[model samples]
Target: YQNDIGQREAERGHLARELHDNALHQLLMLKRSVEEPTAALEFPAAYELLVADLRQIISDLRPATLNYGLRPALDGLVDALSGRDENGPAISLDVSGAGESYGPEVDLHAYRIVQQACENALEHAHPRILTIRGRLEPDLIELTVEDDGQGFDVDAQLDLAKLVAHKHFGLAGLYERAAIIGAELQIDSAPGRGTGVRLTWHSRDK
Candidate 1:
């Protein structure tokens, strides 16, 4: 358990470094060019390309703030996942309620949960309609990702033997992350039916 936590922390650190060295640095350089307009650079094209790359980097970071506060981050995720043009599956995002901030740990875990849920829907179930919902209540925040895709047996598949053998990928990781945040994760799905995932985080202030 300690090792796993350490590893996760390390990954977060690495991501932070990547953001600082790569994405932030590039943005700064681009900003300089934009400021100095007569620096022999093409007007819109260079600026546009630079901005696009910066956006891509920001998208890659996908900071946890989106998961804990405002709907913009998750909305960005939905838009990106939906791609430049909607391909096969249709994705929707809806967020409601107040409180747009959370502890760093809670935010990070929530962000990861959403990310994992989306990946599972895309790769495993290949759903036709995918929805990501976020609701912030007085004492808790709830996030749900639903997919009208083929479901699986949550219980049977979660057998100790199977889990030990490293079968399911995303759920277990999600469960651990939720546990870290003192949150609850619910997976509702069955064969031939759609999947609904619910994650609830309690407020620290009580």
Candidate 2:
């Protein structure tokens, strides 16, 4: 399980590098093109547009507030998820906590968990409302992703001979991640109801 988590982390790092080096680099260059066109264009208007584009690009790169604190990081994450194209469901993100730094592994795992949940909602659930919430105390951080969509029968799935015969990896992946951070992953879903997943980690203080 440790090896699997390590491999996934490596893959995520590689993908992040590709996004930063290729996609973000192009966006920055495009932003510069409009802002640095010599005296050929309206300087003020072009500069303003470029500034907005640059802000978005930089936000995509690292998120300004995320570096400063948790609220910003989550704000940036919600913004990114909510900004998905027309196919994406409406999403609401709520965060609460005093400023405190978490281990990099915790932050990364939390971010990836939300990312996966959002993907599942978009590609599978077809939800109308998706809410991502995060709460932190002095000793723990809790994250939850809930969607008002058709849910599944967890028990039935678990009982299925085929599923038991071949290990399903979706929930397993999340379980492994929670273990890495000494956290717990709770999944609640019932047919005809909605689905909600919770990830909670013990704080260093604890």
Pick by lDDT: which candidate is best?
Answer: 1
lDDT per residue for candidate 1 within 96-180, as digits (tens), equals 8764667566766777788789888888897899998879676787899999999999888755345534635466667777888
Q: Give the residue spans of candidate 2 off by over 4 A.
A: 2-65, 158-170
List, residue by residue over 105-200, the lDDT tens digit for candidate 2.
676666666666776666767788899887877677888989998888877664423432354444555666677788888888988788898988
- Model 1, backbone clash pairs (residues 3+ apart or across chains), number: 0
Error of 1 at 71 (Å): 2.3
Report lDDT (Cα) of residue 131, candidate 2: 92
How much lDDT does each candidate structure score? 0.74, 0.69
Which candidate gets the maximum TM-score versus the true structure? 1
The regions of model 1 sitting more than 4 angstroms off are 2-70
lDDT of 1 at 155: 81
